[model samples]
Target: MALMKKLTVLAGAASAVSYVRKNPEKVNEAVGKAARFVDEKTNGRYHSQIEGAVRKVSETTRPRTAE
Candidate 1:
């Protein structure tokens, strides 16, 4: 049962990665919304930390264009 659960998680993760690669903007937007919801729920307890992590992820995942 544990092995099956792990496999299911891995499959879901793989699918999510493929979707994110094809739609980074949408993923980022979703992340932003999730962070906001958590922040509001927690009354800004982890707001800065969440924002920083999201910013770093967005920068890293963004597609670079030739100048």
Candidate 2:
């Protein structure tokens, strides 16, 4: 059972990575929505941390341009 769960998680991670690579804009949009939800739920208590995490994710997932 544990092995099955791990495999499932790995598969999901792979799928997410592929999706991010293919459509970084959509990924950023989803992250923004999640950040807003957290901010509202916490009444802005963790605003800075959430914003920082979102910025990092956005930077890491952005599509790379060719020279």
Candidate 3:
């Protein structure tokens, strides 16, 4: 049962990664909106952290180009 649960979680994560890779523009837009929302909610207390997280996520999800 534990193995099954782990497999399920891994599969879901893989699917999410695939979707992000395929729709990087949309993912980045949503990430930006989410970061803005969080920043506003926190009154800019964590603006830098939010921006950094957004940058990291965007970089990770960006589609790779062929050489």
The model with the greatest TM-score is: 3
Ranking by TM-score: 3, 2, 1
lDDT of 1 by residue, 13-42 (tens): 999879988999898998889999999999
Q: How much lDDT does each candidate structure score?
A: 0.91, 0.95, 0.92
Best by lDDT: 2
Per-candidate TM-score against the hidden true structure: 0.76, 0.83, 0.87
User: Model 3, range 1-67, lDDT digits (tens) per residue?
Assistant: 9999999999999999889878888999999999999999999999999999999998898667999
Residues 24-44, model 2: lDDT tens digits: 988899999999999999999
Model 1 residue runs over 4 Å out of place are 64-67
Worst 10 residues of 1 by lDDT: 56-65
Candidate 2 clashes: the total is: 0
Q: What is residue 23's positional error in candidate 2, in angstroms?
A: 1.2
